[model samples]
Target: MPERLTILVVDDDQDFLGDFEVIGRDFFELHTADSGEKALEMLKEEEPDAVVLDLRLGSGIDGLETLKRIRETWPDLPVIMVTEHADVDTAVKAMKQGAFHYMSKHPNIKTLHAIIQKELGSVRWKNLCLEEIRKQYGEMIGRSAPMKEIYRLIARVATVPLNVLVLGESGTGKELVAREIHARSGRAGHPFVAINCAAIPPALFESEVFGHERGAFTHAVSRKTGKIEMADKGTLFLDEINSLDPDLQAKLLRVLDDKAITRVGGNEVKRVDVRVICASNQDLEKSVAEGSFREDLFHRVNGIQIVVPPLRERAEDIPELTRYFSRRIQMKTGRAGPVFSGEAIEALQTYHWPGNVRELMNVVERASVMAAGREVTVQDLKLASRSGKSQGFFQELLFLPYKEARQKLFSRFKSVYLSELIQRNQGNISKAARQAGISRPGLYRMMENTDE
Candidate 1:
């Protein structure tokens, strides 16, 4: 049988907690905290899978304060801010503060269940090494061979503070990888702030990185902190760092050289202690050789390089990844559809995936929404297959070591069988359970075991 999820609901009102318990009992092994202080204490004893926090807790620490404290201590904990005082500002603030989602005091039970499912999507990687990735990037959702290797590399690197340069195509989630690195390293508890060098205008580059005084510029009315200063005592991810101009590159070199920054229009040099993780899609070496990027700066940030392989290379991971994307889309849209057929999976595996994982995500999302029925067909994938393209069966085997190779084949068989079971019963859980000679709970357990 599937193990029950443990959930803690914190509210000042005793009656509300009672209602939550009644509604959520079947879905979770419920725990209640009447106060934020008591919730924190209980959390220390054992962390809950999810938290339902009321915005206005009586006295001591209010919901916002408690949320801040939780983010400081356990940043990964999923929190749903429940409140009657629902305003646009409060909702935005709660989300920015890292509450999983915001809900009204009296939410539908179905909505609550949907929220739980969404929150659980992010709860993973308890392994310290992988936990670092989860803590930083939220979740790394791909069971593909390439992604598995990336996860393995993350595990290996999380313990060391190496200046990692993640190389990948533009939309391939390099920042996500950088966050994983920071989360896994000794700096996991600290901030993993990102600054896109290409996004900042040349006029504001220095001010963006090093901040400025109140009167630094004509329109500057107040003292503003820079990205680097904000990332002090934490990990600073320079996304598309190759786009940084030579002058700013020199300034960056100085910062790395002296571990300090001189704010725009400021005479005093302020010390900053931070771990730098730079990412780029450009040919950084060629750029350095061509005088567009600094060679010395390249040396500084290239201590450890991780090349994120393109999605096409790891096409075997398509099915599980498709399911993952499907689940997320389902949660987001509050409507589940476009379950992939075998031919559809094959079509996805055959695609070039020129845009890589990000592209695949978009395609899957669109296909799910557009498909007439719940089942996604090969045509839904929109990949033009070559008339005589090799099945690449042998190529799939080459990506894995012997143990993993065996496991993959076994897993594939299990997945195919499970799909057939569900299809044969027309998605009737109890009938399928009876046909498979397993209890209802056991069926759910098996479903969880397989990524299907």
Candidate 2:
């Protein structure tokens, strides 16, 4: 059976809260709090699917202030604000504050119930769609918030024929994202060509991307088709696109604008229908600002931009990723896969992965081959010590109680790990926060608490 959705209702009126017992019993599990203060406390304990907050609390903070705090922590949680006396000004304020819906409390409880049901149903459908994407795209893994948002964006842009720019650190599977988009797009039947812009030599770069006529240049014995032509009616993914030569960037821009390409040493302009997807590890905006990249070409390819979070940001998916890698190794060797101990998994999660998913796969494969037994212990996974302090840092937590250990681990990790992260980004909090997959304000708060 499916699990029941939980709803947290905050109201000062005990009589009004009691009405939910009869109305929501069949549809959801309901939890009630009398005032805004109690509601905030309940949020820490109960992971509610939706919140029904009263606009005017009899005591404590008002609903708007409570909603503001809730948005800071749980930005995606659905909130429905209901007031006894609804006004246009109040409703506008609630909506602007990120409330899912604003409504006046009517005598009939069914209206509110219907709204909650509809919202929950939409959430469930979205989750199911994400799960389907996960099952279909084997190469693209992770169900973390960042990955889920990427999946949603992929689904939204798959049908639309627009150039896309994928930005992420190396080994974050930018190519996999491009492939998934092509596989789900309208041009699935056609070719999906890929070229690493950084790998090709400067001399051969133009010939590789745009085909050459016979005897056009050295080693051009016969007329050749370029990546764009090969991917006609399909997708052309340019990996490490920031490395493209300035001259080629202009040529590429012209092809995108005209939907045609001219072969080297040939006057014929070939018309091709190809969707372009560009991936870059470096900041193309900075390159454009420094005059190293063309601003016009950047705009041409950046119709839609998608940023893939690094592995450290989605550490919750580490264990599953480890399992998947272990299974692949087992298939190749025809042996049983290794089972990771809880401590080993936790150790993996604590490490700051600079190389992202590719690095994790390498670590898992190495550990699987080196493990003495079927169960992989923490020692089997020889994780590199970051700054020579991680070994002692994690060892210190082993003696504490589970709750205390968790708190201490998080606190220390925020101080040490986040500090190093910010430093690595050269004190740019926005860049560090993006790599860490948290809001800038959230990072500031964590850093401030660490200082305290």
Best by TM-score: 2
The clash count of every prediction, one per candidate, is: 0, 0
Worst window of 10 by summed lDDT in candidate 1 = 385-394
RMSD of each: 23.2, 15.4
Predicted candidate 1 versus true structure: per-residue lDDT over 62-92, tens digit per residue: 9988887676546578898999889999989
List model 2 lDDT by residue over 1-452, tens digit each: 23456889888988888876776576668899988878866775555988989999998899998887677445567899988999999899999998989977643455666776687788788779767866767578888999889989999998998899999998798999999999999999999998877656666777878889999987889999898899999999998889888988888889999999988989999999999999999999999999999999999999999999999899988877887798899899897655666567888898887767877887788788889975577788767533244566578678889999899767756765775566445577876776577888998988888841
Collision pairs in model 2: none
Instruction: State each model's CA lDDT, in order.
Output: 0.77, 0.82
lDDT leader: 2
Worst 10 residues of 2 by lDDT: 384-393
Candidate 1 residue-wise lDDT at 51: 87
